[model samples]
Target: METDKRNLGGRPGITVQDVQRACEALRKQGRTIGPTNIRLELGRGSYSTIIRALRNLGLSASSKHKGGE
Candidate 1:
């Protein structure tokens, strides 16, 4: 199997400590803990990266249900 080129190269990955710091800061400020908010607080991470970090922190994406079966 071939790997996706997009995932081949980019800036260095963000550390768990970095994510934790941003999360703690947001919590201290009474902010919601979400990927977008965390990214904003970090000021330098991709959406996917932030989401992965959130997952590592035990946060999962909210699920959406279809209506009108």
Candidate 2:
């Protein structure tokens, strides 16, 4: 119920860390989180944003894991 206009969890624009946090949250709920899901959560247009985050996280992101999204 706490919402701030600025830094909506970090910054005005979405960041890789934001997507990663969302993914980790989904995983905690026992749901499979992927780039697509992260994009949706971040209100992004494509998976590229998520891919960038994956790369920054040192993830392979070779379409073999994370539900192949």
TM-score for each model: 0.66, 0.55
TM-score result, candidate 2: 0.55
Best by TM-score: 1
Query: Which residue pairs show collisions in model 1?
Result: none
Kindly list the per-residue Cα lDDT of model 1 for residues 1-69, writing each as its tens digit. 222112211677565566668777777777777777777898877777766666666766331222331
Q: Model 2, 1-69: lDDT tens per residue?
A: 222112232324666667667667766665656676666666763466566666666664443335434
| Model 2 stretches with alpha carbons more than 4 Å out | 1-12, 62-69
